[model samples]
Target: MTATATEASPTDSYHGFLESLEEADEYAAIDTALGLIDAGVPAERVLLDLIAPAQVEVGERWARNEWSVAQEHAATHISERVVAAVAARAVPRPTRGRVVVACMDGEWHALPPRLVAEVLRLRGWQVTFLGASVPAAHLVSYLHRHDAHAVALACALPMRLPHAHRMIEACRRSDVPVVVGGRGFGHDGRWAHRLGVAWAPDAPAAADLVADERALRRVRPAELSQLADDEYASLAKRRGELIDGALADLRARAPGVREYTTAQLDSTVSDLGHIVDFLAAAVYVDDGSLFIDFVRWLIGILASRGVPASAVGLTLGYYVDELRDFPRAARFLGEASASAAAGTGPRAG
Candidate 1:
């Protein structure tokens, strides 16, 4: 009666499970998972095909504006509960070797790594999932006490590349090979390769790599040398000044903005700081496209929230003006804001 992913016949129930997730029925979601496991469905398939795909659908719904942020959070939270229920069924004391999985510091998207941990656990591997936002220092310290066959670190945001680089190097120093994945590392995981670490495109790939001892790569240095430049550091030091300057200038440029509520002001300030943080990461990695891509994505987010792209363009201009002495920073700002800087066209209010 064993139902491994390849042999699982409960596709009908899994769709019903997704419907429950969309409805935010936490009880039903848990029931769906428990019922599948009770029906002899393989635990691996439950994670690999069911919960994992549902989480992706949640994100897609949010991206397409079909689901509100609240709805996405509700669906994701339900998925987390479902994963725990499934993992609770994992056979106690797996004979396979130990593996440590963690999300990069400041990277809070932990579901993907959790899914991988459960899959590996079902496959008889001992998995210590460090959960979301693991500091590099804590991870290195953890490895000192724990002997892991491999350490997999997940980073969901490219903005966290700086932390990822440091964590990868720390793990390398411990002689424990690191497997890096998630959207943060780009489609081919080019950033992981550039930083001198093994790349896994998804949980399945990571599991396959973990199973293949030869695929566990040992990397040296694990560093992106361009980080030695002072531009990123200089920008970081001036981050507060940049935020204040942009907010002040924005107020002057758009006098009507003063009428915005306290919440709106806070949101505006937060978005401005993200611009700085993302720009610093781009500069640290020497990748202008990171800034450009983030800005394009952010423009959509702001437009969805009823904020004009031109408002973001104004903040970009402030960065360009404040960092006038820094040609690279100014150049990135201009390139990233090209579309926003132009009138929002017929799409904008």
Candidate 2:
């Protein structure tokens, strides 16, 4: 950690450490974290209060293209290391029952779960920190073997909501209660409730929720009985075609997009998958706003990287044309396309 003034404010320390993250200065990041602990900050507080905020900024910087993917990954990797280092020195209190912490399938963001796992340990709960993207089946098998009191599943992206539903159901089949968290569940946990699971808005809440006897009661099975139609499923089945067609269209019309480096091209593919995935999830949850809010955020990301806002319109129009029969998708895509065409998509904060 970089040296700071004797009376530096929290804001100053936050921004200063964030710069160290952007610079990929592992020593500075680690040292700063250690120094905070030495200055009487609790290890869990350092992880949640300070380190977590810096990590969030890393993602925001990447989303805005203010930082490259490599920088984002490097910084995230260091943040994870810092969590482990802090946990290594912390003392666990009297033991509570065992719990399992894992990410939903297809969710590669493991840092959030890792933080929660460590926090649970510090709170005196024995935890199995099953890294990232654990299959639903694997989770059930573990429940059968270890007899965990509860499962804490983390999902960091809205696109993973569908999979979160799957994991939630699998846990129910094995009769294990699941407490779901992460931004994917929405700030108010609207999706988590719809998916029929306990929702934790943050790590501390998750720990508190885990300690609640009522939360561990097996909830009802997930019911997306909200949507009267199957538009989301239909689009998801044709997702491959959507991506292929979009790539071909980009190759034909978008200058430089077709000639992207391997990394750039892969990122484009991932971004497209995220778009399709989120739209499907939004529809699955029967919320048109999810897709629109996402579009606004995506536009800001693309704009920061010099991509034309109208590109969002082009891509969305393709979806509208393909799903012309799906009234729900068509309506949402149409509205979003208009927003893109008029260059009015919302910007990232």
> What TM-score does each of the candidates earn?
0.89, 0.91
Global lDDT of each candidate: 0.82, 0.82
Q: How does model 2 fare in lDDT?
A: 0.82
Give the residue spans of candidate 1 off by over 4 A.
Answer: 1-15, 218-223, 342-349
Per-residue CA lDDT of candidate 1, range 306-326, in tens? Answer: 777888898998788788887
Clashing pairs in 1: none
lDDT of 1 at 103: 95
Clashing pairs in model 2, backbone N/Cα/C closer than 3 A? 1-28, 1-31, 1-32
